[model samples]
Every structure is written in C-alpha cells, then in structure tokens.
Target: MIAVVYSGSHYAHWRLADRGKTVASFRTSGINPYFNDEKQITTLLNKNINLIHHAEQIKRIYFFGPGLASNELKDIIRNAFLTFFKFAKITVAHDIDAVAIASCKNTEGIVCICGSGTNAAWYDGKK
Candidate 1:
C-alpha cells in the first residue's frame, strides 16, 4: 500500500493506494497559522495518525508539500510518521514533482498551483 500526504493553506489531504489503486482518502483543516508552531505540528501529527488508523494496510507513504523543503519541517514530519506508523516506509516528495507530473499529461507549458501556496516550473520532457 502507498500513502500520499499533502498539506495546503487551509487543510491537509491524504490518499491511500494499494497496487496502484487508491483505496482510501482523508482530509482535515489546518489549525496553526505558522508551520513551525508546536500546536499546529501536533495537529498535523494527529491527522496523520487518524488517517493511518483507517488504512492499516498502508506500507509506504509519499509525503508531498511545499514546506517539506525545510529541514526543520522535514524532521517534524518524519518524527510524526515514525511515532504513528513505525512500520511504514516514508518518503518526502517535493510539491514541484506533483505539479510536473500533473502537467505532463498536457504535453508542455507552465503548471501552477495557486492554493495555500504557489509553485511553478518548466518541463523540457527530459525528465
């Protein structure tokens, strides 16, 4: 099973997949205004635990977010995943990768995600 987790400006979302097929999904509101705050971090951890509880078959998790580029945020997220689901293999993915993949279907151009944050990049097809 594979889990894809993401956080937006107002909420966080997660998708669970088994054998390339999505099996379950979850979402929750963002509570903290700042990403570094302990309370807000705890809220994210709780949400992850809740999501994992519902998808016990998940064996690996692919985390996606903008703030994940920061080492501090990465540590926090890594710790949270370990605390909740120790057995699952966790991998952090840049938000840009998601944008690139989504845009690839259209053949070329700029793909922008203007939600809680913004990201843009050009793909030459060499990827």
Candidate 2:
C-alpha cells in the first residue's frame, strides 16, 4: 500500500492510502498558530508520527507541501520522519503541483484552495 501525507498552514496533517482498487483518506486540523514556531511545528510532527504509526501497511509515503526555506526547519522535519517511519520510502512533491494534478477535469473553470494558505491553478480539459 502507498500513503500520501501533507500539511500546510491550514491543515495540521492529512493522509491518503491506495489499496488496489480502493482509496482511504482523512485530514486533521492544523495546530494553532501554524508557522515556523517550534511549538506548532512540534505539534505537526507529532500528528504525522501518530498517523505513520497506524499505517503499518504503507510501503511508501509521499509528502506534499511548500519547500521549507529554512534549512533548520527542513532538517527537523526530515529527522522526525526518519525517526518515526524508518522503513517507509519517503518522497516530497510541490503542493501546487499536487493540487493541479488532483484537480484535472474534476472542476470547471479555476480550481482554488484557500485558508491560512492558498493554491490556484487552471484545469483545462487536455491532460
């Protein structure tokens, strides 16, 4: 099975699973004051750790989020995931790109996601 995880200013964490022809998904509220702060970041990490713990069948994990501009934060998140899910293969994808791909032919006109953060992309019929 494969697991896809993501977090952003608006969401603390989210997970999706692909199992043969079935798919499962869920989302959690973002820790308060979502940002680069230590407390909030730790909370987010804890949330991810919990999710990873329950997904024992997940062989791979794909993370989608904005690339951290701060190397310190990047290292922190990387180490946390490694410590929590040592066996899972992890990959990161740009948040905008994920949104664009997911929105393909699903909605008419512009597809936008907005909250504490925002993402917008045009979804034409052609792939």
Candidate 3:
C-alpha cells in the first residue's frame, strides 16, 4: 500500500493505493510545520476520518506541503506523521520541490521558489 499527498497553504489532499489501485481518498487542512505545532497538526490530520481508520494499512506515505524549509520543520512534520501512522515509511517534502522534481525529472532546468522565501537553483538533474 502507498499514499501520496500534496498540500498548499489552504488545503491538503490525500490518496491511498493498494497494488496500484486507489482504495481511499481524503482531505485535511494544510499542515505547515512552520505554522502548526504537534497538537494542532495532529488535530488537523484527524479530520480525515479515512486516514485514521486506514493508517496502519498504508506501508508508505509521500507528503508534500508548504513551509518545510528547515530540519526543525521536517522534524515537526515527521513527528506528526509518526503520531498517527505508526507503521508507514513517511517522506515529507516542500511543495515547490515536489512540483519541480515531478515536472523536470532527469532533465536539467532551473528550480525556484519565490514569494516571501525566495530561492533559486540550477539543476544538472542529478542534485
């Protein structure tokens, strides 16, 4: 089983799959490690009743969301995932990097994150 999630500032969407077939879909409020504490993130994640019921069934999870810019933030988000999905292998990433990597793949191009926290990178497609 696997799970994938994408989150922006306002919302997060979750999809769960088994043997490449989608089995469940759910949504929860955006969980930004920069803005939410453990308790708040836990509460928000609980809003998705399906996730709660199927947490243990998921073997892996890929979550992309805003505000995951530091190790502290990653730790915070990881803690939140561990709190609920006790058995899944979880990967949390910044939303922009998720989009960039998905779109570019092994092709070389520029990847940038603008707005309040602006960053730019040149990619050889390896790093």
Local distance difference test, per candidate? 0.65, 0.57, 0.81
Clashing residue pairs in candidate 3 (N, C-alpha, C atoms within 3 angstroms): none
By TM-score: ranked, best first:
3, 1, 2
The stretch of ten residues in a row with the least summed lDDT in candidate 3 is 114-123
Better of 2 and 3 by TM-score: 3
For candidate 2, give the lDDT.
0.57
Full candidate order by lDDT, most accurate first: 3, 1, 2
Question: Clashing pairs in model 2?
Answer: 12-30
Give residue 80's lDDT in candidate 3 (0 to 100). 85
Q: Model 3: residues >4 Å from true position, as ranges?
A: 111-121
For model 2, the stretches where C-alpha displacement exceeds 4 angstroms are 16-18, 21-24, 29-55, 67-75, 105-113, 119-127
Q: Over the stretch 1-127, how does candidate 3's per-residue lDDT look in tens digits?
A: 8889987766788889999899988777777877789889888777777887888898898988888878888888889888988998989888776667876788888888664456677767655
Which digits, one per residue and each the tens of the lDDT, describe model 2 over residues 29-95?
5423224454545455566544645556566877666645456655545555555555667665546
True lDDT of residue 123, candidate 3:
64
Q: How accurate is candidate 1 locally (lDDT)?
A: 0.65
In terms of lDDT, which candidate is strongest?
Answer: 3
